[model samples]
Target: MTQSVLDKAFRDVVIANRILANEGVVDAYGHVSVRHPLDPTRYLLSRSRAPELVERGDVIEFDLEGKPIGGDTRPPYLERFIHGAIYEARPEVQAVVHAHAEAVLPFTVSTTPLRPVVHMASFIGARIPVWDIRDSFGDTNLLVVNMAQGRDLARGLGAERVVLMRGHGFAAAARSLPEAIRMSVYLPLNARVLTEAMRLGEVKALSRGEIEAHASMKPDDPAMWRAWEYWAVRAGCGDLLTARP
Candidate 1:
């Protein structure tokens, strides 16, 4: 069968994920997914492969039920449940990105929460809750592979743009793969700024009102996409911005 639109979208996500991975923002542990085109009950994401090295043919397809539908792949991400459950709960979300960016990884292992010390993180506001999977399972490395845990994480995220997985990593969502990538890149930058500010002493979070004000201050600027396009071209994936699956 010819590659479907859903497969193409998955390829785009894989490309962006690889770019971040090559930059060391995301390594072997993270995953990215896009909602299926014709089937809202399905999604497209990379299977068990190094995110930085993923190619178009490496993408996989799966339904909400977690059954693999595409690729001659072996197995999918163990935490595929996260993608399935999030899409199940939030119809407005079209893409999801989970990465262990260096700046955010430290906070995930610490007792303190990631306060919104910068404007970027302020999009979610205050302290983003760290979902402690270690507490849920006996081991910190246990993957959230079931619907029950997935739904719990979804509830913690609610309508927010990101969720911190305690002792693990974090997840970010957006309307498209590129937009989701923007959130992933921005989130770590926000966390790094907050962490450094904490070391320097007293850091104040942007108030909810201030965040709203900032939103009105700049509506969907092209700076990020432009930057991504530049780097993507250098990384040899410039065509991804317009390529279908």
Candidate 2:
């Protein structure tokens, strides 16, 4: 890849992982993915490492089938199946993020859904249905090594950008790495806020109509993009941010 494109992808991945680590959404467990340049059937991901430690050169290219391509020297990530399953199921998604954020994991262990506790969380809406892996398939485990199980996990996401893996973390997809990062950040924040509010015992949340109204709006607002750019610069991610994707 040219320096220009490589820089953009590299920075997006690094900064995103760093921010996720800072927010306590991801530690050594989560991974992120970006669509491949030469073939949409392929994507780029890093070998297993803490989101906090993801470096620019750690990114590696792999086919959507979860096979490494090119002459890249690094080993592929163990969670590579999640990225492959997501891309296979949703062509519209350009990036994917899987993280074990604090707030989201609670819903996984119980019947509770990652409901739209707030309007801003309407991106997921009532569609944040937990995948009943046991019911879907007699087998209930879906860790990284479970490739077929990962595909079953993607089935719960539908067309939405986020899925809260029951007893697991979150798997989100977006049109770009920044958007994926934004969703990853926002989902956990929104979940935490809602969880806190509900715990207060008396809190008001948006109705389905209201949530739908907000969600129908385009997510790629210029103001938010500008905010991301500003923060990226402040975080010293500008050199990579300025590069063309």
Give the number of the best model, judged by TM-score. Answer: 2
Where does candidate 1 have its weakest 10-residue lDDT segment?
Answer: 214-223
- Predicted structure 2, TM vs. truth: 0.86
lDDT of 1: 0.73
Please provide, for model 1 over 1-245, each residue's C-alpha lDDT reduced to its tens digit, 9 standing for 90 to 100.
23556555765776776777866668777888888877788888777777877877667778875678854457788888888888988998888887767788788788877766676555544447777775555664546788888877887778777889876788876776666776677788888887888889988878878776644422225654665576577667777665322
RMSD from true fold, candidate 1: 3.3
**How many clashes does the backbone of model 2 have?**
1
TM-scores vs. true structure, each candidate? 0.85, 0.86
